[model samples]
Target: MRLTSAFSILCLSAALGTAFAASPVHTSGHAVTLDLISGQGTANGGLNFNGGFKGSKTFTVPLGSVVTVNFQNMGTLAHSFVIRKGGTVPTDADATDAAFPAAYAPMKVEAGLKTGMTQKVTFKANKAGAYYIVCGVPGHAMGGQYIHLVISKTARTASFN
Candidate 1:
């Protein structure tokens, strides 16, 4: 009877540990993970290219938190990660603009490739609002290939909505 009770307690403890570690990311508390992909748009094909061909996604994080993004570059050509300031949108949907390198945050990975590559970066979610994540490739940011990361003041309460 004693041995059986001990075994049961051990099992329960292990299960609880796993559950605690598996908690979903929150907005203002712990660090969250963001996965992003980079590539070219229709403009790359040519000026005559009619169809848009770009990839992007937005992620939400908590205010004053940390985030880890496992980004992948799955496009033909070199690409880079650039965090731009708010309210600096381009007039052309596919136009490129110059960003402040000093203010821009870059996460280094292998040179962008068509086959795809992965890079992990961690940053503080100091700003409590919306921000843009884009590829520094000449015209990539102007394309639809950009992601919006919104940091809120609550824990695990962020959503694309």
Candidate 2:
């Protein structure tokens, strides 16, 4: 009887452990840093992400994760970070307030940081698709201050039998 009880408890513990492991776990997500630089010369400045200039850069994050962006203003002027998931890409003709699509109107972020300032913004990567991270400082994005953010599908974890 003693041996049987010990075996039962062990089995219960294993079952509980497996159950816990199979459950979806909450995570604090990931972080990436970007620098907002103004024009160095005749070339328009951009947000540097992953060692690439804006409008030509891409950042990847897992879906269902929280993404934190640490933006540093390394320029001589003020700038902001705005994120949009859908709609036409803003152009020089669009105003900063109208740059983002109406569908993503709520997901925008404007840090309004001055030169040599830094700010942090966090958002959930619930959707899997291409997102735009742009500077909403009137002419910044139109001047090539933007990045493409790709939210990839989350990897599935193996479950214990």
Residues 60-126, candidate 2, lDDT per residue (tens digit)? 6566555545566666656666666535674422224422233121133343567666665555667
In order, the Cα lDDT scores of the candidates are 0.49, 0.50
Worst 10 residues of 1 by lDDT: 46-55
Q: Candidate 2 regions off by >4 Å? A: 1-43, 46-54, 92-111, 154-161
- Model 2 pairs in collision: none
In terms of lDDT, the best-performing candidate is 2
**Candidate 1, residue 150: lDDT:** 65
Worst 10 residues of 2 by lDDT: 98-107
